[model samples]
Target: MSKDLRESEAASLDNEVLSLLGRHVSVRKFRPDPVSEEQLEAIIQAAQMASTSSNVQAYSVIAVTDPALKSELAALAGNQAYVAECPVFLVWCADLYRLREAAKPHLGGAATYEDSAENFIIATVDTALAAQNAAVAAESLGLGIVYIGGLRNKIAEVAERLGLPELVYPLFGMCLGYPDQSPALRPRLPLPAVLHRDRYDAGETVRQVKAYDATMSEYLRKRTGGAKDTPWSAIMADRLAEPIRLHMKDFLQGKGFLRR
Candidate 1:
């Protein structure tokens, strides 16, 4: 990313892919224009090509374009209007149900969650990689997208909505369409703060964070036209003060993950 683009001192390598990725900003407000079927298929193909753990490809995506369904999902996802308004909403799932079926004949039974932690992590990681590929593909095609992790807020309801079988869990939802609003790129912490010299160090952590917080505060101020000026730490702390999806353990267990 160019310094002119990010307006940050974060070290960046100049390249086609990095330039594309570095300029990314989540698109919340989208135009009502429809994303073409051809574009959607191409994006999915890109997603399908992402690497999977152990070649398991243990994930699936549900494309929801039904207005009624989207409306319900919008409510389920904390009433985020974009969930319903976007031209396409996709639910990415961490899936093992298909694997169970594929392996059933050889094992003479469905696969159990004996390696629950490992399997669960693999599926989640696979799903995220696939979704990111799709997001980048969409951006390349001149579309906009926003990831909706809030889908987890009503996990059971989302499962019901999508008729998701056991061994499948909604990781997140994504809204895609033509962008209606252009948002400023969010700043990131400087490279030295995150990149280590092959060893762990926290000596500069506080200093880097304080400086980054000032940058974030300024960004927020300009972005909101002075309506919001909360610092990054305060905002994150407030978010962390809320439940970190306490139901996740039981829910994933019930969905046949993390049983061990």
Candidate 2:
């Protein structure tokens, strides 16, 4: 590549990364092309490079390529067919079980003492950061990815299917493959609504959200052939309004994560 071409490529790569920042859209449709082994290796390496709290590295990733497992996972995750169809389904876990077991001697035969909310928080954060890095890397490689937060909807069932031990929580699942369809970028909260200077400013939050609702509604209509006219706020409110809300406390207790 010539110097000018190199410079142009560098600028384009920068734009690609930034585009991922805002233009990132969850791709549910994917081509039949399998993600290459080299690409998968690079993505995992990027994930491992993510910072961990106190270097504890409290995270584990399970790559599911087995058709049976993917089908089970898809059913457990609210029948998300894409999870089964995608070439790769990565399950990211907030894992402290290994460390907790490893520190058994330090706990004087009561390793249970080390299991606390603070530990859970650290593991979850570490896992989330690592997973986001993997997602970004996959995006950079001309691949499509979607976060399956629904994986937590039935935590116990998912854990049982995967045969997970205690102290290990499934944070989320990720679907990865080549894109068969290109969807428009999902609208985000306007900058002023979320990017506070120092402390959080809620002064114009409501107004900004109202404006965003209008913008997103139009986008949705155009995309969905005027079928669904849902606004962001309404969708969020509905999600928060349920009482039992697909209870997960029992499952979490079983998994040994002391949310208390």
Candidate 3:
């Protein structure tokens, strides 16, 4: 293709992808319709294609479809009803167990680094990337999804219920199904606040964040019909003040992760 034609095609593709990503909204309310097996397979295939560190692909996904199991998980996830109501609940896990098992025969009892902090980081990042890819694929298929971070509220019990072995831990859960409601998109931090040029610019970040606070405040006010107008910074401050998920460090260590 000519240079101009190639550039045109690239821009067109970029526009399509950007449009799909820019409209992202978490759907808490879902329709009664069930997600098909074919759709689920396609989503997982897309997730598997996500980039991984050194191609370790140290992640696993569990799709919970049984009503009873979903109900149990819903309770474990702090009573998030959508966890049970959705057609599919996917538990994304940061897993080193598979890799360890695969290498055991070849190692001849040699020491392994699967328990190192660096490996923990890699597994966590790999799981997140794969899950995001699945999320995007589901959205493209006219399905809606909501991530259930509350799955970590009772991580140990959740892991036990799923029968996860050593070197594996649940990172998060996702509820997937057809949408029953259309919620407004949540506002995000301004691009300038997150994207720095060459070196970190604290002053510019502060200024951009202040501007974003105003944007979020308006969004909250409208969303709640004037019931809330809290700025982004104040909300984040509250989050920091709370001792949220304080058990994570100990829990991860108990799971044989992050030893180093």
Q: Report RMSD (Å) for each prediction in the order shown.
A: 5.0, 3.2, 2.7
In candidate 2, which residue pairs get closer than 3 Å at backbone N, Cα or C atoms, i.e. clash? none
Better of 1 and 3 by lDDT: 3
lDDT-wise, the better of 1 and 2 is 1
Top model number, TM-score: 3
Q: Give the clashing residue pairs of candidate 1, or none.
A: none
- Which parts of model 1 have CA positions greater than 4 angstroms off? 1-13, 109-115
**What shift in Å separates residue 227 of candidate 1 from its native position after superposition?**
3.3
Residues 177-228 of candidate 3: C-alpha lDDT, one tens digit per residue: 9999999999888898889999999999899988898999999999999999
Query: Candidate 2 lDDT (Cα, whole model)?
Result: 0.85
Ranked by lDDT from best down, the candidates are 3, 1, 2
TM-score of 3: 0.95
Cα lDDT tens digits, model 2, 160-224, are 78878888889899999998888887778898998878787778777799988888899889989
Candidate 1: worst-modelled 10 consecutive residues by lDDT: 1-10
